[model samples]
Target: MKLYIAEKPSLARAIADALPKPHKKQDGYIEVAGGDIVSWCIGHLLEQAEPDSYHDRYKKWNAADLPIVPETWQLKAKTQTRKQLTILKKLIKQADELVNAGDPDREGQLLVDEVIDHAKPTKVKKQNAKRLLVSDLNVGAVKKSLSNLKPNSEFIPLSVSALARARADWLYGMNLTRAYTLAGQKVGFKGVLSVGRVQTPILGLVVRRDLEILNFVPHAFYEVLAHLNPNLDQDINSQTSETFTAKWQPSGACEPYMDDEGRVLHKGLAQNVVSRINDQVGTVLSVDKKQKKQNSPLPYNLSSLQIDAAKAFGMAAKQVLDTCQNLYERHKLITYPRSDNRYLPKDHHKEASQVLAAIKNNQGQEASKVDGANTRLKSKCWNDKKVEAHHGIIPTVKKLQSASLTKDEKCIYQLISRHYLAQFYPEYIYNETQVEIEIAKGKFKTKAKQEVNLGFKVLMGKSELDSEEKLPALIKGQKLLCFKGELIEKQTQPPAHFTDATLLAAMTGIARFVKDPEIKKVLKETDGLGTEATRAGIIELLFKRGFLKRQGKQILATESGIALIQVLPEQVSKPDLTAVWESSLSSIAQKELSYQHFMQPLLQQLSDIIELSKTCDSSAFKSLPEQKPNKKFRRKRKTYKKAS
Candidate 1:
């Protein structure tokens, strides 16, 4: 008997249908012919042990328990998923053949292998793999993948990296949160006080901007404009003339910036230029045409997909991940959703068309869902060479199980469908135009763009296209109308509040505002800010702790948040640390550096940062606007006295 495991039950069922003599059981799993047995776990059935789980005495929170950093982390079956573990265990023990069939990524590998650890499989086990790594849950793809499973050892490095990430997050989050909460409580605040490695730096960004706004003062500036009536025949070079014609040439255009406070900071005498023209003839400099092709974007990886989905359909990041997971595991319409790589191996290109053809046949499915109409194309996001550790998010050509879809699932499906079809659709082609004008001593210019061809427009089948802004051409100096645009001074805006989108952007890279160019260049190898998987949790930690506040879509840092960075004796909130750590991790991944070599400095820095920040003065940070200094918050009383 062979035991097979899958990421989810829906997927297990799909695999079971392909095998012979399948028997489905409620608590257990489906049994197929030839004495083969298959089972599944829903996501992570086993997890790293919690601090409270370490001992009965540590079950509750207390101030004395400042940092619950564990030396030897253990594993346990999660309470929510123990039953599935039991089923898998029972099958693994009796079966003669074993297979690791989890989702095909770090998280997926963790889910399956950890369960195996729980089951206590025998050594020297000859396991056959059910490598069903397709985006769609179709029968053909699933069956093909099962027959080609590789040995488990091949994925050891991936599992190692995943586990390391998990451990690091746990260590950083637990210890920091405990320390911060205790520290805050000592100062009369009674909040849970949370902290995360990724989140604190992120919160710092918001806090800094808020301070700039609070400290800002506004100012104004003045300038003049003239409506020009030029001659059409002779070429009048405005660049050579000395007058303020550039500012007056346009009907609509933007001037320039402001200083610290929302004020127009201007310096030096105003500059201007003028040109002599008969206002009769304007000669066309040149009308140039060039053919340009825009290739379809590479397939949807985790972050890119999330951003695009959010922009196009207003979906949340977490929501997009969940839907993509379901589509991959249940419907089997797509590949892995948690991947970061957008490129594929050269080998994958050969069979790419099968996916394309499937979507084309299911036009209604390969296209996005339309309102008030049943006839439409289906959705798919696929690329062969463009895929990395996993292929792009694409729908499998399999006929969808429409009944099983929830409302959210349908929306996700629509998002995936549109992206997939767009790949095979044609390259977007357009004609671009550039124009230059010189007026006044200062040069003023305007540009106009015209669309000649939209190649992939046919794939959308006359669907609504993105909007464009362009104006009819004005050949060289052919001035028909005279419109003098006045110089309206614009005050500079304080840095914008961090929205979820902007926060994510800032979190994605470790690039800095540092003065040194060399230091900035080194961060290129480092994953920006944080990976997609960890960024949300980091932000959540900030909110859970009083360090950050959520006001509708905007993220504001709390007083504590500002103070933490201000008093931090060193740059704990700086991206420099992230960059250094990233460079080390890249070295580790390439076998060029060992873990000890990488972590020793980190541990030292951690100690230095914690000690330095704990003892430093926070005067500058405390004065920030976010704290609303002098305003008091009433302390909440957790303990009540009755009938005194």
Candidate 2:
């Protein structure tokens, strides 16, 4: 019998539904069409064995057994899902062929492949495994993918990279967590000081932001504005009369000396400028008009989609991921939702047309506004070279079950579908007009924009509308009356706390934060901080571990988080280390670097980090509030004494 294993049960059900009839449901496996059995992995069926699994002595958390690098790694079935693992093993024993129907990414390849290795016994003949790369859960895509299954061996590098990453994280998290937790105990700190390759750096981002906020001192400054009216003959209150605000330029010594932030440092100087420009008639220095065009935003990558959902609905990052996943698996309305690529394959033009048709039929008036112009097929979004493991998240040809969607699901679907519909619309065209007016000895500037074509904005609604000031028709040499002038006092503000949207952007573009040149360049070529599939979980982990807290929509680092950063070694807290490591993982995936070569240096670094931590001062941890020893431990001691 042919056997298929999927990443999740929802995905397996979608696959079963797409296949021909005879999908009889069983306890864990499904009797699908063509005598096929479909089963699903609940994410990872087996995780790397914990440190205690390596040796019983390792469980006591002794500094002497500092770096616990296993010679040969072990895997254990997750207790909650061991029964499912058993079911898969039993099926593997009976089946003549197996299909690795996991997600189309490095993690997914490893998730199912690793389980196969662990479940199948040594005596059982190894069945030929084929990879089924299905990005969309729709019937056509699923059938096409099954017809062209690639040999599973073709993706061994991806599995190797995934395994290497897992092992590296294990070494770093396990060894370093033990090292620090033991050190903290000596200082009377009772809690575990958890650290990971990605989580720690992300924590540092929050802590660093918190520090900037705590140390920020608001600076007061001033700005001068002059209100000018064109056509002096017309009454100011008349509908035809045009007026605009011009900002005074700081070119002269007497004028306010502008600071780096563009704020005038001296209010008296600004007041003097206002007084000089007030009630003066000035000639327009220049009227510059340039036409510009803005293309519609590309389709949703997981990160971009997460950002939009957060801004529009105040939904958390994880919530957006879950919703998008539901849209893909449960509804079969979109392609795989956990994609990093924002462009579709060049050959997807036919599929694009089908998707557009489905959107127009189901979504109603908003989609009808999309022109589907002649140039739609030739858009830059359809580039074969740019398409990576998966294409951008876009609606499928499947008729969307819109009526059944919840409010949030509807909002997310519209946001995604609109992007695809926008590709056919023309660019948003506008003419930018800038006017400079000379008032007395000072120059004042005002700008405006005129919309030439609504284009994509017509479908995007009011949120994407351009609100730039509209300039009144004027001649370059004409003079205008400065009807009003004022000095506006303002205070320089600190950077805003990170919202879920901004935080996701920061995590994806973390290379921008690094000062080191080498690591920054490495990070630029890599998916920053964490994979799109993992970043939401990483953020959630931070909150669960008390490293990050939420206040309204803003993310703040807790006191313990701050203390952890202070005490942790630079390699642990800084993002540069992870940036370099991620580069190696990428190389491994490309077959440019072997797993051993990558692990060799990583193992050496792990040893070096442990040595560095031993000699380092531990006093930095004392600043945090101390917690009493565990009451359970104290009770255990009293019971032992009574038994003795």
Q: What is the C-alpha lDDT of each candidate?
A: 0.57, 0.81
What's model 2's overall lDDT? 0.81
TM-score between candidate 2 and the true structure: 0.89
Top-TM-score structure, candidate number: 2
The superposed Cα distance between candidate 2 and the true structure at residue 354, in angstroms, equals 4.2
lDDT of 2 at 319: 93
Candidate with maximal lDDT: 2
- TM-score of every model versus the real structure: 0.75, 0.89
| CA deviation > 4 Å runs, candidate 1 | 24-26, 51-71, 118-123, 126-134, 212-292, 344-386, 400-410, 438-442, 457-486, 509-523, 536-552, 558-571, 575-593, 616-644
Residue range 55-160, candidate 2, lDDT tens digits: 8776466778879989889999888999999999998878778889999999999999998888663433344588888899887888877788888888989999
Give the lowest summed-lDDT range of ten residues in model 1: 635-644
Per-residue accuracy of model 1 over 82-150 as CA lDDT, tens digit each: 887887888878877677777666667667877776777777663443344533466766777777767
